[model samples]
Target: MTLTKPQDLSTEAIATLIGKNARVYTTGDMLTQDFVPNRVNIELSDTREIVRVWLG
Candidate 1:
């Protein structure tokens, strides 16, 4: 993933955008019981139709 130039955007906006795709740990989220509200796990694989798993 590519990042934009953070020139005038606030930290909150940046963190929110990042949290949209990945996890973000902050003072408020970490302090409360909703630190990890969602799971951002991803499974990327190469284009292959093998019996098991084929990667290049």
Candidate 2:
């Protein structure tokens, strides 16, 4: 799925746009610094709201 404004979408909505191998996380969570070129990173707010979307 494609979004005109991904950061404005909900976590569940964005999750559906990604493949099964995507990475989903929220603020304050500890994550590895390693970068995987094909990985899709979805960052959510503390209240489980979608905040940002990007690829590695």
Best by TM-score: 2
**Model 2 regions lying over 4 Å from their true place:** 1-17
Model 2: per-residue Cα lDDT over 1-56, one tens digit each: 66554355444655577644477888888989998887778788866566787787
TM-score of each: 0.22, 0.62
Candidate 2: pairs in clash: none
Overall local distance difference test of candidate 1: 0.33
Clashes (candidate 1):
0
TM-score between model 2 and native: 0.62
Candidate 1 has which clashing residue pairs, if any? none
The worst-scoring run of ten residues by lDDT in candidate 2 lies at 5-14
> Cα deviation of 7 in candidate 1 (Å)?
4.7
What is candidate 1's CA lDDT for residue 55? 15
- Tens-digit lDDT track for model 1 on 1-56? 44453234333554476564343232223222344444332222232111231111
